[model samples]
Target: MTSTGTLSRAQGTALCVGAVLGTGVISMPALAADVAGPASLLAWLALIVLSAPLAGTFAALGARYPDGGGVSTYVRLAFGARAAAAVGWCFFFAVPLGAPAAAAFAGGYVADILGGGHTTMVGTFLVILGLVVTMNWFGLRISGRAQLWLTGTLAALLVVTVVAALPHARPANLTPFAPYGWAGVGAAAAVLVWGFAGWEAVSSLSGEYRDPRRDVPRATAAAVLVVGVLYLAVAAASVLVLGPALGDSPAPLADLLAAGVGGPVRVVTAVVAVLLTIGAVNAYLAGASRLGAALARDGALPARPVRTPRRSLMVVTAGSLVSVTLPISLHTSMLLVTGCFTLVYVLGTAAALKLLPPGWARRGAALAFVATLGLLVLNGRPALLSLVVAAAAVAYASRSTSPKIRIPSSSSAGSIAPKPNTNPVESLP
Candidate 1:
């Protein structure tokens, strides 16, 4: 049986926007300033350009397949089961590793609101995770109306910050543009991509769209461009207002706004920041659950009670355990997951190139895939590690005797192939 309900174009776009413009927007500026300073703007620009076609490729793939498993399904259709499984495994690892960190981030923000130390912060983290898991478990839709309100409010907050800080702009902060060299810019770019990774998550729900082929790609591209511009604007504003000081502060925008505007604006900004983080959590929880369900349906995971209230809770429990056990810091875990996602996109774009028929468009997609692979690998160690693991997964899958689970080729009813009849060996008469 197939499920019916899907998102409208606007909802799809909002989901994509929400996924990309998560807590990273608030946190990444500081990291960028530290690693690349003014040069980080260039890195942002590079990513903007690189991510466009990369995202577009995903949008196109989703439009074509319009199924639940976003990147995994795309890769599977273009390559084969082994390649698909590798992508799925990488994505699965990336999300679990990153979830705890995200919970930690939410905890920190909650602490900011309630005034607490590490113990309170951890409690807040678990509470927030549990609440979000419950919300998803209960079938909260994050409807178009909700997305509009959250996205609009977040955009307004950012605009307010940028406008308030414009008077403080100092071009001097941009000097020594590559203060830490181009390498730092590359590192920042890799990290920044993490902030933008979820744009494709929106496309995974293409099967639910009213007219996925027409709507999904358009919404995906629009969301990417809008978010890219927002990031650039915010990054530039951070440099202008906070300069080198931005590097040390976690909530640089809020701090800059608090210092510049003061009074009620500070409280308001704080509230919006919390909301933005919540939106991120919402998007992540929803996307991850759907991806898990898709994988389960494909027999990639042990078939469990998917499409149930319990699934999100299960993921949250697993996320909590991972958060406690992992040695890597929250920020570093985000970067590592971002790196894993980049590798996923590299394969995704390659799949797009292969699946799309030969043409100028196909050639362009192939070029973009190559470029994305290069950028992803530029992270060196993490990128190399992810690649090695993917290779191992592919090798294992190729040798395994697992059932070949295939999606029916035709969309019409009665398309499913019938099983052949087999008779047991007869006993001697």
Candidate 2:
């Protein structure tokens, strides 16, 4: 009956949009189309459909629990402390890799428009990296507010892009669907998982909602519709309008924009890419920094650099810089990150099976669990990284926590405390 929250339903919906939409639409269409030709639409549709139950599962958990331990708490309650710690590590580390790949995708769009090649791309990455980091340092409430504006603009642009481009979509392009074979659809779906990552990330913010049970479902439903429609519109437009040239095109959205409403859309699309990247990176950082703080509190990491959100931000910033500088292909980095995200989803949905009341909710969780696990297998060898990171998390926990806790004397006899697996990625305030 009572409501107390700083975020409105609109803001909650906006945050969901920002987190789930991501920069995937900027480049994922062409990459996927290249793999499966017009058949890539299957991947798009499948994942979009899967998002409903996936997001629903999280929304149910968020509303039911309504705590800062957004996702990890559920895993802790369903499984155990170590399993929850693994969830925490998977997400806390996933964002560092995801951020750079997202920035680079936007950078590619800028490079296409400005004609500076890799230099332009690298510069764009640096600018966005610094920008989002600064935003998080100040607190993401500012960034979250901006997300409301960015999501609207981004959605408008997507609709306009699709509508304008639809006239140019040729039926001939779809004739030779499954160009690489039906297996390509699987590959494309695996790639598309990057776009659908933030469903659980929203759970991290459930505690910020005014009426968790009432508003969480409404906001989630709105976000699911918005993301599913916009993404499908963009992906279908890319394959139908761009046809075979999709694979070679560096900026699919800009190309689609040019084909329909021919103009200086490369520049406009570049702007879209930047805004998209900012919205996504800001959301992930906000979530990840808080997760790091919780891990420190829970004894998973050294208490010095992550005891506070600001310090945790530094850790994330440092890890991201290293991730960006490493000599890895954009394709490879994305797989690694999505692999981690899928692992988190597998864990999250499994937790839902236990936490949700019996009935359709539980049935949906079972389906989602299978779906995410299948996607993880599609990640191929890169998915192995998620398992490795998770193992490291468990190992770290085992080594870091002392078996005994001693009372602090009058001075400072602080002893190492036993770690509690609170499923901490959403564990932060």
Candidate 3:
């Protein structure tokens, strides 16, 4: 793997875009349409608008202190070991659930075209999990480059699909938009959380960028624009082109293409889904593996076999297997996965609010914190369970934070101090 500062802005942007796109783009349109009808488009727009401040908060922190540990590092800088461990736990545990959810969303598309049910889905999940783990094993430079290529191809196909489908969109479909009322909009927003999440993925790779300060924010900005337009276009097309049928569509993008091109292009959307899922899961595996290793080095957990990050990867793989057993569909699984990352966002944004100076930056962070918290609640009981996990992790970590085990100068990301510093927080690195 290349050392820190080796990645260019283009690579950084690819990481961000790949991380943000994923299963959500492929499946969320139908799910949100089911929840809020055409008004789901509003939920799509709202989250895209909110993504700016939320992404900026993490981007600002990454620019200041580039680290592989990402949001966990920012937490350590602001709140010390306990909170940091908890955020790390949230992220670490999220991978297993999110990976399976991502895999399943794409698998659903494949199953639809082939007719094999969960058996096909399980096979798809296993193949995807194995492929991404293997890709990540080679190292980030390869993975990041793969992301750039994957996203480039995914973006081109998506742009073509949206443009071709736009001619089929009818304004009449937008009428009776709020058929389910405003509450439905909120419900739709909760589902869209999966779609909007992923800004922090780039933060975890911040140190790898050629210039974190210059590249990370530029990457984030470019990703925001890319994801925002693509998502809104797809969401709008699903509503206006498919209308009531949008909610029931197993493969909305394919259906949209079929409407425009006069035949099913299951092959087209399915290919996009597979490529997007690979990039998304690969990016998460890379970030989570590094954060896991950093946690081990800092004594948040026990060390494992050699330099392979084998333990963390195994945990994620096993967790995905277990997740497959749950009696949930892709849409529900997305909500549960979104809850996990929303918890991470809440912590990171809260940390920024606490650590940043009293100014627009901090205010933006505060807004993000409140928005994420709202989304967290919308996630319902799943979010509460995540909080319980965090509380337990914090209590356990408190006992392990001995003076000698404190973060060392050589740690790749955020390091916990042995004792809390009473001086101004600016003294922290």
Candidate 4:
């Protein structure tokens, strides 16, 4: 097959930006504010600073080793197949389970605007899910142009929201800064991780860049700058303009808009929320489908009569639908998903430590590794979900490679020492 690099530097930057932007932007500021008051801005800053090295490390790896296998490939190269499979499974399952939670974020906005409460939210979820599944079914339904437009729309909306809201800012909002105390800032930072969750995804696109060695770094730098400035701007404006009420605003951005421009902005905010949700879920499902196919091809997953991206996508979408029906709270589901992605970040950065050439890049990877490790710890008991998923992947790989035996068969040459299966899945899963 002839391969041509189709993504320009601008395109790559947009992709990275979108990856890191996430659905959290709609609500994170308020959630963090609730946890830390105006001091949550510090958490926003901490996350932004952390993103520099984290994004750069992945960009460096992507430039050096451009492959479809992405972080999983890097992991396989650094630590062998089992670890790679574990990483793959973490991503594959993370998506669908996370999907309902992601979609519901938008649903809340819709319900706020349309007034059907839970019914409205659930209806919105179904519509978004249906759109995403359709978009992914024939292969990635969103064109690059569509994604570019999506990013543009979001960037524009955020800018307008912040700029409009800034004039309303009051110094009194910052008077006591840490009303919840310094411990609250830490709590806020923990909540903010969702906003910064997708930088590691930059690796998957490295192979698509026109000149990855040169462009990956540039794109990543651009993305980090944009993401940092935009996110901080929104968060700061939320605190400064909305003051004490910021924490209680379900649609914080809309509230900012109303406070700034006054009247009837919920509809616009709801539309933005829907667009953001679609883009996020689309990206997750698209990437996971491809990952599933790759995993099956490599033998980490069970072989199907037909192993294709569509098949993988369906399985993932199905899981997402089932997750929506489950009795779990959206908050708990998100935590579960966050745990999986966090573990992926941990493993990806650890892999980068082995794969990158020495000096700044390797050092950056170390920094990312430590940050992500701390995040995993912050996840507390929810993080145990990642461990379980990883273990399942390893077990599946083991089953594929070696047959179970009765007693301790002295035949080490057989199942006991069998060669390992090397492929794994979505892990958007």
lDDT of 2 at 368: 96
lDDT of 3 by residue, 290-325 (tens): 676556655565545211344566666778789878
lDDT of 1 by residue, 1-429 (tens): 232434677777777787788777777888777888888888877877776777777776666667666788778777887887778667765666666665565456556666675665567556656655655554434444466678877887787788888888899888877889888988888777777777556655666566776778788877887788788888888887788888887667677787568764545655665666666666666666666666555555544544322462375458656665767776577767777787887888888787766665466578778877776876667676577668766776666554554544423211111211100011010
Q: Which candidate is the best by lDDT?
A: 2
lDDT of 4 by residue, 1-429 (tens): 112456677777776776678687888888899989999999899889999998888787777766555676667668867887898889888878988888788899999978998888889989988887775554321434456678888999999989988999999998689998998988787677777877765565566566767888898999899889999999999999999998898889889888888888899999998988777776676567666655665566775721566677778877887888889987678778888988999999999897776899899899999999998887778889999999998888776762321221221111111211112222222
Better of 1 and 3 by lDDT: 3
* Candidate 2 structure quality by residue, lDDT tens digits, 219-338: 999999999999998988888899999988888989999998997878899999999988888778777776666667666677788776677778888898888878899899999999
> What are the clash counts of all predictions, listed in order?
0, 2, 0, 12
Per-model lDDT: 0.67, 0.81, 0.78, 0.76
Which scores greater on TM-score, model 3 or model 4?
3
Weakest lDDT window of 10 consecutive positions for candidate 2:
407-416
Query: Model 1, residue 359: what's the lDDT?
Result: 63
What ranking of all candidate models by lDDT puts the best one first?
A: 2, 3, 4, 1
- Please give me the total number of clashing residue pairs in predicted model 3: 0
Model 3: residues >4 Å from true position, as ranges?
A: 1-3, 305-311, 402-429
Candidate 2 to truth, TM: 0.91
